[model samples]
Target: MTAATTAAPVGHDTAPTGHDLAEVGRSPATLRTFLHGLPGVDQVGADQRAAMLATRSIKTTAKAWAIDLAIRMVDLTTLEGADTPGKVRALGAKARRPDPTDAGCPPVAAVCVYPAMVPVAAEALAGSGVHLASVATAFPAGQAPLDVKLADTRAAVAAGADEIDMVISRGAFLAGRYHEVYDEIVAVKQTCGDAHLKVILETGELASYDNVRRASWLAMLAGADFIKTSTGKVPVAATLPVTLIMLEAVRDFHAVTGRRIGVKPAGGIRTTKDAIRYLVLVNETAGDGWLTPDLFRFGASSLLNDLLMQRAKLATGAYSGPDYVTLD
Candidate 1:
């Protein structure tokens, strides 16, 4: 089967229209019907197709282009509890110039940090063209109350974060309290004001591919500018099969709404080959429109080092040792 042939059409009974879009989350019953009506994922097929695409290769000049493109798509992230201002500043510097010795190296797409560190990141990335993203709404776990989550988001934006990554309440979503989840996303987006809102589904805990699809559509319906895969704190962060499912969701959503939404696969993407596989997946599944940094991003810290080493290999015909690239 072709790359585009990943899943069946979203069930006809709930296929979204302008009116359907307007009515999506009006009530719990309405949200459940629409989400449950989405077509079931062909799990075996998804795994096989992702494996097939991974076998496809880019060589020489095309490989170089893919490496650079992947570099630009990376959200150079540092979200550790042990994180310090000095460490954040170092990450900001890396975001501005991924490879200090190479002038041709393109800067990363953004730098993501906790809400408290947003001000530090904002200062370090000042006027550098790289976006400042903060994880708020009680990131990773997302166990806070609605008012607390809103306050968390407000503080990040007020601190100069241009992008806010908020986590969905997985407990509510799992208990079929989708309206609660929807209301929370809407509230967070409102708090974001001009900043872009990326809704994290934390798919690892969602339990199944069908749940992943349902969560993806639910987040989009609630006004997520981007649907993110994981928070990098999960054991199953960012797999190719999961990312493919999200790509297909965004593809179908755009077909209905004529509005494009981005996809971000955070965590466990640490190699040049891994990044290229995701890029190819985007190209094949979502078409070229999603290939740019505006629509796709890899939330990673060490992935940049591998891409830079591979880029140097292509340019100099020799592998640059790990010593050449700074460790994040």
Candidate 2:
């Protein structure tokens, strides 16, 4: 089916009522109980569902449309110690014009960078429709003290980050210190001010599917605009099953809260086929609203190039090598 194919709309199954909201005040005990009470994730069922979704087939035209949509949803990123101003500018330029030869190519959703490079990215992406998202809060580890994490978040927002991707404290969460994790997220959300917050759960380190589900609920409860799967630093980054669990979390979170939260699967996803498969998962699981960049994003850099090559092939009926697209 084409990306434009319409699907039957579904309403919230368990939208949080006023009583539920009031019951889940900032109290850690209440929050912990609520999160722990979330429906347990059946790993076998979830893995089966993700595997089934990945096997979906799309025609050429539909795949093309999905490719463009995937490109638009990409958070074109560069988060390396070697990241320099010149490299950031080049990345911004590529994000703005992913396929310079084709005017039909759409700009990516945003340019993700380290907090210190936000100014460089801002300057490079100026006038482009791309947003600036920075990774902060002792990213990848989330091991630092609460004060330090908040300061990191505030500095990134001050540097002009439209979105802050904060990593949750896996150490605390694994230690069963759910309250500590929830409170840290709440504090960081406040520091974000107008900027959006995307909380990374680092699912790989979370151990089981159950912890991922609980962490998802905890992040959403603490006021994350988007719930992400990983920090891209761990050995096992984003995976289909992990991402599917996160998507289900957002879908369920919206049901009770009447709030729309985004889901981002970062790290390992690197092909048009993989991205389209994810879009299919979103379409079937979260409904239509989450299909947009506002509610969904792919945290990727190399994924863009493969998409460009595929788009070029579709346009010219010829294989365009890596040389055709800008390398960032």
Candidate 3:
């Protein structure tokens, strides 16, 4: 059965939902055929690819903002927390002291931390207005049982995470058990109570364009407040091609239900050019409705310093030290 439509999660709660993306029951080939038709994918000729690369010519300020907008969807794990903590903490701290005179100091949308480190991020970003997010539901691999994933989500929300980022069962998804994937996402969403649910698709492993589209729709139908790509665990996380498919899914869902869905293209997205391509995909494919950071996000682990350096260069014609954009 398809999930009945429901309300979105609270503004800043980190709870996960329990509903799954109901099976559309469409065949894989059908889904692929549907996906291949999206203009962003079909229209990308060599010229367009070259144009995307040429986007490097954009003002560094533009590059900086695009990178900044994306790094906000970062997914930090408890295991990786120790090594990456310095940068995250510094960024959180630096976020607290924005230079009002500098137009480039806009804050990241959120600082994604492990549930255990929510307090660390909360304290670091204290009063700076940036959100705190956590990845639950057997993050990275998501190879755990359903109950385990739900418990992880609830725990993260309790630990002070304002948003929850969870991965779908790509294992099940690939096995053709679409309902299982849907149910898992739904369960996490229900558990989130008030937190936003950003569903990760791990597009790299989905293997086919059709699988990506089918999985994307199933997730949104199952109750994903946001459809995200990659967990940053795999070599290939958020690529323009994968993101393009997800964006089309969001657009189609909106057309069908008059409900606007959110998209987060995450993982492995490093350079300023990567950020702009994702943004352009959202703008040109999903249309302007998804442009704001509210409707779209890009997950990244190393995008911040690049953004800061580029921003600094734009402002002073030279790069600055990592300390210049200190994490909290």
Candidate 4:
């Protein structure tokens, strides 16, 4: 794994390095000029590279470490209308101890739930090392007004959520209203207070890889700690190619600004093999600095179960059967 050259950590307090970058989002024209000035993504090359990386194999001790790392980097999520307090609590317990049978198993990075469920998750995860993340800004579809979105963010933070996963205004972004999107993210970040802000781009609706790259840069410039791929509600959620582009964006952004932001590929990522592939992507594209949960995460619920099942198999040298882990 290549070491990261930048020193600025995610959420670092220092100002951005360059004067132009520091003045990036001051106006719509500047934001547009900066975003459009970004180097375009080579869609075909990106796809080929991701596919090639997916084929790189990790085995034995390396595979074991990858599984454990993937487990720790997971944002165990339960974002549904039917989510109950009991369900949220149960999920929190799972996040705290993914493998109840093995005390050596590490806890997941965080527990993500809706705003209404934030209090429940907070109560369940109290004093636990795992973080509590809540999805605000009208969640799956960011159609709500700015004031409502700010209120939603404030409510979640007040309810004890340490992390806020907000969705950018796809409508405004698609319409070329880059400043509006940037301002909204800024407002949401302010309302988040000390809570880390994760800006979800909903890349499936982005229509193209260039737009995905633009949205990623916009989120970071607007003070997003992490630029997420999807909400997992859309039919076409996180993809390796899309995530690769995001990784590149963070990598370049860090090279310029000295601020290392995080990247998360939520949804459609299940099984240990899939998780390992993403790990490889991070190591190759953004270097090993992002291997930790602080700079990388998998926003998934079912993905944890698969990691556990694979982990058990590695420890015992036998498949733990279909009933080895609970179904999320």
Candidate 5:
């Protein structure tokens, strides 16, 4: 949990340990065999682990630290059809100065928006120190052709996005076209250039924990800087069990390849308590190394104000309401 003032350069390699060099240039069949061979997940054990971690409590000093850390790790996202330049600008201002009354409060990690809104978001966040991220590759659906998806990714990068959150072709993955999903991520990574790439698995649609584990490996093996849980548009977004699986994948991925990949649990996480629970999961499961904003993030919008209100309570010894904070 470094200070929010620390600079977060896009595509910065946080883990220098290194990955399996041999796995880097393998054929599609070889890679698939390697990923599938990686042990299967025991759903019951994973669920118990997640449930047990969620009950860990924090209070007083630890509570305050978790609140601030959660604030700094937020993506502060706003992805909707009605998004406007004014809305994006307002969101950026909020990200830079989350609490107008309390300058000590840390700003959010980044601002996430649709590809069409990248220019507006980039301009709004120009000198704010908060990075701009765009969702490309047809976003929530990811049903477009490879060329269209690549073009969509390039457009976001050209518009000054520091991070690109691309959705994997779930249809291909489910259809056993693992190579197609892997190649798409590889191509998108090249298109990203200096920008960091986050591959979203959309776990709910994937159907099983085994598929989730396999998808996690597929994205990381193909060079995804971050492996995310969902797009927030699906029936089920980020859940404790699903997130736990991704965290385990990253931990094991680092153990096998010695490379560190970030994990983001987006959507449905709107409360300060829920955010802290996820922090506990990260601390216990992935170890404290992933506790920083760079290696972990919450892709959420409403969660920001809740955290601010909790921070205010810690300082003033009183609870606040929506009227006390901006509605962005």
Candidate 6:
């Protein structure tokens, strides 16, 4: 695969601080020890490639779609005429307004939109049984000040988002500014109120399994409700090896703190089959509890269409247009 194909999409044009994986001093022995303990980390090798391919032949089922594969699709989804709060509200209303029998895929775990679109999703999903998620804190580029990041988190929640996804200050993080990274997450978590906080590590830039693990643990210690990989806007994102390392982090964090933070692999997933591999990872690593929509999610822009198409194929044994069920 091309470097562009697998590069993390989250960190882009942030202030370059001459940081890379080598600068972090992440211990390979530590990452290996952690990986060995995870149930499926071994699959990060040749087997992962085999498994990803295997999922291609597995048919999509409604039950699996709802229980295993549904997640908030983001990064690439753009709003039409969402220039004003009113337009956002209308889009939210449209998303909130779905039919009980309209092929019935689980309304995505939530609607993820730009910070400007948070209120629209919040207002639109309100009382409709869906949730609102927003990307904030100099998102995709975590190169802003700590207070600014905290303020961004606070702003998103104030505007009606129930969840906030923030990028870590890669510059600080790569400088071995662990305390800065820790404090930023803690502050953001504090500002969350009733909202959930998803900390994005932008793993591809981290460049190795060890840094990914360290970043994961640091975020969990600092108070993240979930740990996500990439913003789907960068070069490398959501790869199996990176995800394997992150999964180990979640498992280790759970053992240490008894808290289960969610895991979301965003960026490159564009097919239902790929989604299922992530499902299998969740099931095998975190067990049945992680199988629910609450703990596991896939972030994608074009993935929804593939899912819908596959779902329709299961029902009628024929293909259908993804736009045929337009939310508008």
lDDT of 5 by residue, 1-328 (tens): 3221221111112322244436543676766676666667777877887798788888988899999999999998989899999999999999999999888999999999999999999888888889899999999899999999999999999999989999999988998888888899999999999999999999989998889888988899889999999999988999998888788778877876878999999989999999999998887777788998889999999999899999999998999975988887
- Name the candidate, 2 or 6, with the larger lDDT value: 2
Candidate order, TM-score descending = 1, 4, 2, 5, 3, 6
Off by over 4 Å in 6: 1-94, 97-103
Top TM-score prediction, candidate number: 1
Q: Please, what are the lDDT tens digits per residue for candidate 6 over residues 90-205?
A: 54544453323453555666667777777666667778766677888888787788788778888888888888888998888777667667677878888898898889999888
Clashing pairs in 6: 6-236, 7-235, 7-236, 7-237, 8-235, 8-236, 9-233, 9-234
lDDT of every predicted structure (CA atoms): 0.91, 0.86, 0.67, 0.90, 0.87, 0.65
Q: lDDT score of model 2? A: 0.86
Among the numbered candidates, top lDDT falls to: 1
Candidate 2 matches the true fold with a TM-score of: 0.94
Task: Count backbone clashes in candidate 4.
Answer: 0
Could you estimate the TM-score for every candidate? 0.96, 0.94, 0.77, 0.95, 0.93, 0.77
Q: For each predicted model, how many residue pairs clash, with residues at least 3 apart or on different chains?
A: 0, 3, 34, 0, 1, 8
For model 3, how many clashes?
34
Q: lDDT (0-100) at residue 260 of candidate 3?
A: 84
Across 50-136, the per-residue lDDT of candidate 3 in tens digits comes to 355335344545555555555543332223745465655765664443433465467667777666676677778767677778888
Ranking by lDDT: 1, 4, 5, 2, 3, 6
RMSD of each: 2.1, 2.9, 8.7, 4.1, 5.8, 8.9
